[model samples]
Target: MTDPVSEFSRPNVAAGPNPFSLSALPDNVAFVALFFQRDHYCTNCRSQVQDLADRIEEFHERDTEVVSIVPESVDHVEEWQSRYDLPYPLLADPDASVGDAYDQPVRFGILGALSDFFGRMPAVVIVDRRGDEPVIAATHRGRSTFDRPDINELIAELDELRSA
Candidate 1:
């Protein structure tokens, strides 16, 4: 298995340069909010992306970049970009390599490993870039389909991190 990705460069299907990476963030960007999606058809995942998109300005105000990682092909993710026109970066992690790197939860053991829809849950990884190298500042690993954090909660976490 490939090692967990501490930093990644992937095709960006949303409003930004192509193939966004941790190294390519603007100098003003202090944090990166990586929202890992469960699958292409997850309603909760869709809602979360939309919610973030609507509040992207808040992240920008905090010098953060909101990136949504979808474990699907670029073509499939493009459909989402077309529908929502997200203001942030929407990346396609088709092979789930990035998800596995972040240890995204998988349930039912072998069965969950076999199918993402059945096993893979959502995750939010906050990467702090204030130091010499980017580091994981916080993580919210969902235990169930509905167990993800709220938009305000994410903003609050970023606010706290910035203050500290």
Candidate 2:
């Protein structure tokens, strides 16, 4: 299996641009926090996105770019962004191309398998982009509906990477 940090080779196509290549991000971007959501229909996912949206400035203060990726159409994602008043960028991966590249869990174990069959397992990936090197500093995966990465923890990771 490939280590999470080494997965920079994976393609990252964003909503606005032709593609938001991770490797191509400017050096000034200290880190990137990518939140992967199942879809706009998931209540838990919506809540999570809202929480991140509420703290968009906190992320920018740390020199990190925050983006949420949803496995839905561009129209749906744009609607969600407007509804939530999200300040960060939202990328549409209708085909889960980025999710597949990051190996997002499509099958949520044995019990939740049926419900999450088409769901992209929730995840938060923090990549340090200081200087010329972009390294994965942390990776969090939610196994259940209630599970999520702590925003405080993400902030701490950014702080730690900045000081390193």
Candidate 3:
């Protein structure tokens, strides 16, 4: 895989027509949008969506917006909403084309040189009006995820951004 920092932070990839810019959302707000790996689709992160819901106040304290981004137009809104108890928007990225624009898999696992191929990388992107680069949540190695986004860690990074 390409360096996460360079892939997401570089001026071109971050601001390109692809890779949904955080500022593109309403109010140029800072948003955390979710993306999953490959065809493993789930609107709500069943294991932790509820946990995210209960602890959403922590994100609210940081003035961060939380939105679940599903790859396909899965009509499981009510099911996921009820299951996760989420009070946030669940946006669809169609065929995950939007995510493809953001991540061009350069290499993956035994299957090296994957940029030629296409697949979704499990991640969360932090988009804001601060600059071109968006804060990368995690670029999991297939079927993996960086569970429990550390609020304090995120707060620190944003603070550094603001100061810089």
* Top TM-score model: 1
Give the alpha carbon lDDT tens digit for every residue of 1-164 in model 1.
11233877899999776898888888789988899999999999999999898899999999999999999999999999999999999999998999999989899899999999999999998888888778888899999999998889989999999999
| lDDT, candidates in the order shown | 0.90, 0.71, 0.45
lDDT of 1: 0.90
Q: Clashes in candidate 1: how many?
A: 1
* 10 residues in a row with least lDDT, candidate 1: 1-10
Error of 2 at 81 (Å): 1.6
Per-model root-mean-square deviation over C-alphas: 2.9, 3.7, 7.9
In candidate 3, which residue pairs get closer than 3 Å at backbone N, Cα or C atoms, i.e. clash? none
**Candidate 3 local lDDT, 1-164, one digit each (tens):** 21233232111111112333344455445535343323223322455455556666666555566655545444443455445555655544545555566562323565533432233445555544334555554332233333434545555655554455
Q: What TM-score do all the candidates reach, one by one?
A: 0.95, 0.80, 0.55
Local lDDT at 84 for model 1? 93
Q: In model 3, which runs have C-alpha deviations exceeding 4 angstroms?
A: 1-44, 104-119, 131-152
